[model samples]
Target: MAIGVAAGVSVGTVISPYAGAALADDAAGPSYLLVGGTGSSNIGVLRESGGRLIPVGQPVPTDTGTLSITVTPNGRFAYVAHTVSGTLQGFRVGDDGTLERLEGAHLAPGRPIVGAVVSPDGKWLFATVGSVTNDVQTYAIAPSGALTHVDSVTIPGATSGLSIPVVSPDGRFLFAPSFIGATMDSYAIGFDGRLTPTGSQVPTGDRPALPSVTPNGKFLYITNEGTDDVSGYRIAPDGALNPIGRFPTKAIPHGMAITPDGRYLYLPQTGGQSVNGFEIRDDGALVPVPGAEAPSAPGHLPGRVVLSPDAQRLYVIDTLTTTGTAKVFTYRVKPNGGLEATAELPVDTGVTFSDGATGVFASLGPA
Candidate 1:
């Protein structure tokens, strides 16, 4: 009975942090999934083992169509964003990594809350709202896992609306890119988890949709849908940006993920129906891996890429355009930066996938 789950919540096996760590130490714990999309329901839940994902139960309902989801650092909670209604939902992460919606967890940060990201310390959650309003809401996380609204910052220059707010791995800076402006706005996270605009925004390629920072906090990469390339930046010590270079990629690339080792970058090209792999050089140059592209069915456009904590395995979710249907694929990371799709056929996820990732799976007891 984790806090805020309300009475008679049937989600089974919520484990303690210590027990979860023990399961993770043994490498037997299964990973969990929280996907957001335009479906009959707003969100979906699933579990993963041996590089395959299957629904854990029925899809979890949300206030509207869903956008993206981010888990807290301790693997204890998850926060999901809605595509409409300007609301965000919170959940308790079961010990088995199952999600139990928390009562009174519906929060209206602003109208049309579109993007959400959890601080690496698990102490804060940030969300962007109202492209017209340019509002970014901040919430403090209590020990009981409740969210207390903190402060809101407005970006007057974000006329096109804000993309996702990506926190630096070391938790020092937050980057918010505007899709229409070709700009990446930055903020310095204060000691109290408040955000102050650092004003280090650099111009990206064009129509930058998704931006991801390296796990080492050294560089940032953004997908340019309009430019058909990926933009790279060298992160300054104080969280400023120095233009590294722009690397050509597949068309309409939407998702950007880096391996845990910080040595490789993976971009799922929406137009090509394949994933392009790159070896991350120290100078932030993306050198293509020989035969790094893994082609899939044409309609199955890849959305998200999640890496195993050890960086040995990668999971990709592919979804069709019109229907609420998707397929999840697993790939083995070869030592040479090549992605070898596991022999397993794509599993019919049976739901549109808008949001998901890989982190701490679950902490099971003495499995």
Candidate 2:
């Protein structure tokens, strides 16, 4: 049965089939995935339609060891990073938004993996490995969505790290926020897809986590879990980051994302259990937009925030509770950077999953 989008209601399902792709060709209104805690170490896919989030398919298990997952720009495949297992799992997307495990279930590089992301061109995949081994491994995407390790680069002081690696929109630079070091490092992506340290590390507030780039590729934002602030950096031509502003957040900011229109930013403060919205000024500074805070319901721990392809809706994922149930919230995006509740629904994963279920969903839309 097909899930219908109702006003201000969350809906979900667990099945594998190709639902029709009926989004407009506006370059901004594609469906999204809300990857978070699953019953058994897996990720969930939620399709956004008319400001509501409906479960389009079943949760795809990443085996034991995968922690963070990210989809390519085209949304054709997803890369799952297994922090404990030191492997990355690749999954191909079926027409109905369900995931099918690719030929290679595990790409083991013998390093503790923290995050994985596909390059803007979707030709390569990058994984950040830390703890036991502090390095970034590069892999070429095979035609069948499998990964073949190409090269690896060791960061000087990345021995203690947690944040995932992020590539710039231009695909010329890479940013990795190290929680242990409390800094964000930059690297230059060479022509051959190799990474070269840019020798520039920007000091962040404290325990910096995810680092996201702006839509225009002019600014980078980093969320500091320890200091309760978001740091902004201006993107320099030579792949260097210059500080723009460091603004205070409500509490512990975890996940963050810039809107598709490049006008607003959304960050989920886990400590306060609220989502903070900001207006992006031309100078790269962020000002909290009025009426932009969305509080998480009781007993829900919000994990990440992402925007729909059309920039008209936002999705927030909440990891499951003690009883083993997940949730995804949908919001209508206002022109002035405020959010209105559309739907808040619970997702049922057939099994119980743990902390390794942290990941963000993506759609096949514009860069």
Candidate 3:
């Protein structure tokens, strides 16, 4: 059994990549949806066409326990962090949105990875590993989409449960939240892609799950699952987070997405089984968007919420459900910051409730 998962629940089939050459081109490409889940190796590759997701080809063979996937802003590369196998895999994104495994792009950390994300400049990849070890690894991204270990840092005072890290829009700051410590830790990113402690540890609500920064890079918000509220922070000149205020939400807000313009914020409440909308005030406070409560399908627990690159569509993936099924809920962004139901795409089945699920929109267009 994978670490932290209950007995008898499958994380996926153990698979390895075949030796392959890396692609050298870095041109803009088409958008694609990459989906991975808990119990099966249904690595979906879907392209967005005419307001719907069309399957590109057969499921891509990948390592088991692959719950998180992060793509570069240029859409030239994608990275997968395998929780079960304790390895990091990189792939060169083809022009047609297919994934080609890059030779020498795999790294075995020998511990479970919580998540991985690329810096906005695509120069560095940061991954969080181990529930108890609290280690963060940094890798440099080559032009051929290969990875080389650059640095590793252990979060200070983090006893356990180091959540995923989020980089600032400017790529100068990295913020990581610790559930057990109930604190949000900030780090300074050196030009060489190394991390240095910023000495800024801001207290957050109980069990803070994810941290999100607005596109303007002026404010940061974190979804506090244990407190059933959202914490707002102002990004100081030095990348320190200054508390704005704590705003109330429905219940158990796990994941969130902010619009490109930084005018609206949407959060998925797993306990409430619905998506809530809020207007981001000029001072970094959140005010509920009137009539923006969008409910999820019965028995479905929404996990990760992501917005299309253009900010016209919103997608939420179900982390757990009782119907032996999992799905991605798509919505049209209304003018008033509300969600208009568009379509639901069923992705997999027999998925037990996991704390996090991977759902990312890969922008394939030119940088």
lDDT of 2 at 56: 63
Candidate 2, residue 111: CA error in Å?
2.9
Taking all chains together, each candidate's TM-score versus the true structure is 0.87, 0.86, 0.87
Q: Which runs in model 3 stand beyond 4 Å of their true positions?
A: 1-28, 158-160, 343-357, 365-367
Error of 3 at 203 (Å): 1.3
- What lDDT tens digits, residue by residue, belong to model 1 across residues 234-316? 98888888898999987777776788888888878877788889999999999999866888665677877767655677767
List ranges where model 2 is wrong by over 4 Å: 1-34, 320-323, 343-359, 362-367
Ranking by lDDT: 3, 2, 1
* Clash numbers, per candidate: 4, 9, 1
lDDT for each residue of candidate 3 in 295-319, tens digit (9 for 90 to 100):
9988888887778756788877777
Better of 2 and 3 by lDDT: 3
lDDT of 2 by residue, 1-367 (tens): 1111111111233354435553543245355564644335567676655555666656665544555777777777777776655566677765456666777535665556777777888888888876733678788887678777789887666344665778998898888777778878888988778998885777888887888898778999988888899999998988788998799998788778788778899988877888889999999999999989999878776667777766777776664445556666777888889989874555443334423326455665432
Over 4 Å off in model 1, which ranges? 1-29, 158-160, 321-324, 353-367
Question: How does residue 142 of candidate 3 score in lDDT?
Answer: 88
Worst 10 residues of 3 by lDDT: 15-24
Score each candidate by Cα lDDT: 0.70, 0.71, 0.76
Model 3 global lDDT (CA atoms, 0 to 1): 0.76
